[model samples]
Target: MNRRGFLMTASAAAAGFALAQAPGAAFAAPVRKALPRLKTQQVGSGDINFGYHSAGPEEGRPVVLLHDFGYDIHSFTEVIPLLAEQGFRVLVPYMRGHGSTRFKDKSIARSAQPEALGADTLTVIDSLHHPEAVVAGFGQGAVAARAFAQLKPTRCKGIVAVDGLWRPVPERAALQKDRRGFARKLWTANSPDWRFDEAVFARAAVSFDNPDFAAILTDTPSNAAVPTVSAPVLTLRGSASGIPVDDPTARMIEGAGHNLPLEAPQAFADAIAEMVRNAKWRT
Candidate 1:
């Protein structure tokens, strides 16, 4: 056979082999099973019943997702299917104090320490029976992912942080001054209709009740621990207004600051697909 013909045959053979090994193809070969709907699953040290939503085959490669505070798993609604379409099983859990995840004892305060959240995540993984899985987080969710990866380096297959606001979040006392400044800026930026009750803002702020949350927000600007993650870390930051500077991983995106899934879901989904593919390649 001519050299060119031989090369073409080899390439075709390789492609065929790859297709058979692919999760999508593998599932197609077998009898199809019904995929489950979004449901509550009890996981982690807190034994919290977390609301989980997923796409793609359960037997496919696992990619665990965590979302920012004040947002539910729905924050990732736009990105999960893309990952699944790429042949990855996406797992998103409601973090402690958010959505369906509640403290074991409602009376006991849930501390937002990286270690605590990390431990809880580990517990969830154990409960799910996945020996190893990729972990990714968005916004404040990135902090929990970083902590989880740091604590369970062996178990964490890969890590991705998107538009993390790890920068200094001012304490309430310090925020007093900024509040006035922000109020003045708001006054100039919009009409009186924009004015909202201070009580509404206060309730929103209290959700991040743990002292560590405040400490990290305030110190995140200089904090580099997030980049120290031993697992492959993919950091993404949006470019538009309100993008925070505290992202710890390598910044990978721009043009849609802060709210990546909302402002630019396609870009966000692509970033996650790349991270999962790269992570699988590395492993």
Candidate 2:
């Protein structure tokens, strides 16, 4: 086999191992240990039960950090401490189909579309009873972050979307139909970073076989979404990542990619700090 063929085969295996998904199927989710500082708690919102980790000063400025699709609250283990020490109440919740967060009514739709994620995020924000919060998200979570910022501007004070917004989110309907193929392609392109960071998420990624990949991948981006964000917004990505940067507040870090939180924690933290500093929140 040629170099390209060899590379393709390797990537397919890695993505298969990492995401554990079939074409148009849910990703698998792994079990994870609880953090000492992060209190494990659940909030019943509407018919959904959201399990999340929370720490830091409750009276301090609130910040809600959402993890990428393949990860859970544990994703922000490193960054949350920093913000907490700096007097920020950090809340990291599992997405709809990841971790302990779940829908109370099985009869309800399980679609993880951007709109659904946006609504769920709002539920979390309201349950926490934070009048407003600085919302930050990575990858799929970033899309959720954008939706939250646009749809719930009154509750979302500012948004810091790293490797999430203003990027080329490929709309491939076929990917949903062939999730395994999508995993192969995605992992092939993403394995280099995965190899370096799976340790942070792998064991806890048991449910990698369950997230709504197709609905997420093929979900349409609303043309009117960006203009609706009344709160401040900051878009960021790694310089090495080919993802686009179209926002005025867009920023970049050298040699980073979708896994910016792990590959560049300091830079990611810096970006969040910058977002909070520039946010037009009430004093």
Candidate 3:
């Protein structure tokens, strides 16, 4: 079997083992703290129902959270509360195609390009009624975050990227082996615990079902239409155990990756708080 198949089989077996130990022993769900109330607003002309969970004073400085592809805003489960506790307004939302937010017109191309997403972000920000805010994104969301800053630099105070900055796909010689091998390794590299449900895995498989999906995701970054963003870029890469090593791009942004926000949420929070305090944001 391919690597992904093998890993899923392994994960299923491990999960079974943990379950046998105790219900709670199975891959522990993200902390079960009460979720902040969700607020719905219409952003952009398309009637896209933007959803945001906010915490902290309404008048406090704002920080926006953008998630990765095939991921809902909940990816920030570990980080949002901490930001709110630090006295910043946190807004986490479902991007256009995911969750309850549907495209205003089905005819519109659901292009997942950075520019398209960046525009969607502006609509969401405008709907929030916030004059300006800091934006942070993880994985593919970082692409949109950078685009947003490029498109509306005045509206963005700062940006923090966790596991952001995707390198262009390597040549075939660099792909390790065949497609199956690469897919499995790619999935495992990004998520070691592999806690996704079979249904979720199935959905991800569809995303890759298209012959072009892999190229689209892996190719876009190197050539992503990165707008001229003046906002200070802070990126967080995974450690040796995390994302596949790519050091050159990591150095461009004044940030750290690997065990950054994942292993150290508090440190990440502190760094963001400091960035807000120190940066002379145009927004």
Candidate 4:
């Protein structure tokens, strides 16, 4: 079957969800307190210390959520609770060089190359003792998700790629000049439909302060050889993005841009839930 056949054009209705909260609305204190608190933890993997946030029942089916470049785990803030409530074990890891994740050895290369990021996903899953998981991500996180699927197909029940899957190109020299400005520009350019305030942007932007952020952002040879994915895949794109609609699976998310998790949390979470329900591994 064609790979594009995996694409399911998701909407709130089709995914069995309703947009109860206003877009970008802050959750009420009582509602927030009602949800399971995200447990922050770290695991030593290779030369990197991987930090991740997890929630939901311990025995719940595992689902790993990866955030895009220029953003951190908070990118999935809205989506996390939605999935957790549905009894999915949600794990959101800070990619290497982001958040509390750091290189253990000072001399170790700080590279966010797709292969390295993909390997980290597997490590996070293994460290957490999950047999397998539904891997989903946005932007560069999408790339990592795809890579993980290729690397260890059996471990990934399915993958939901939001916006687009991007291949990184090293531009460290130029990016180094104005990292924050670069990220700000990405937010404006990628999600033209979403009007995020300074506070929202600041929440994720602070992650760029990691010492190795620049190296990882700009470090690359663009030469991670990955095998063809044998696992089921779902591809989603924002109506506002430049991603082509040629593929059969290319479903455009109305009113969303490249940042689907933040701009359209309900739809994003719904996609993952859909994948979980349909996954062959689900017991």
Provide the lDDT at 186 for model 4. Answer: 58
Ranking by lDDT: 4, 2, 3, 1
Those runs of model 2 whose alpha carbons end farther than 4 Å from true positions after fitting are 1-39, 165-188, 191-194, 207-227, 242-249
Candidate 3 residue-wise lDDT, 27-121, digit = tens = 34344433443444434454455555667766668787876543445556567678887678777777654545665654555565677667877
What is the per-residue lDDT of model 2 for residues 1-283, given as tens digits with 9 covering 90 to 100? 1100001111122333444343322123343454233457898668678888887877777788887654556657778878878777788887776667767865777764566777878888688777677888876677677777677777677877765532233425545455444443453244333343234444445434444434433343422133356777777766644233344556867777655676677877777877776766663
| Model 1 error, position 10 (Å) | 53
| Cα-based TM-score, every candidate | 0.63, 0.72, 0.65, 0.81
What's model 3's lDDT at 161? 67
lDDT agreement of model 3 with the native? 0.54
lDDT for each residue of candidate 1 in 1-283, tens digit (9 for 90 to 100):
1110000101111222222222222112333333223455545545455556667776667778876644346546567777888787677877665555655654554555566667767877676666667777765577777777888788777777764433333233432334333222222121111222333223323433432332322222323344357887777665542333543445645555444564467887776677666664322
Candidate with maximal TM-score: 4
RMSD per model, one decimal: 17.1, 10.5, 11.3, 9.0
Worst 10 residues of 4 by lDDT: 1-10
Query: TM-score: which is higher, 2 or 4?
Result: 4
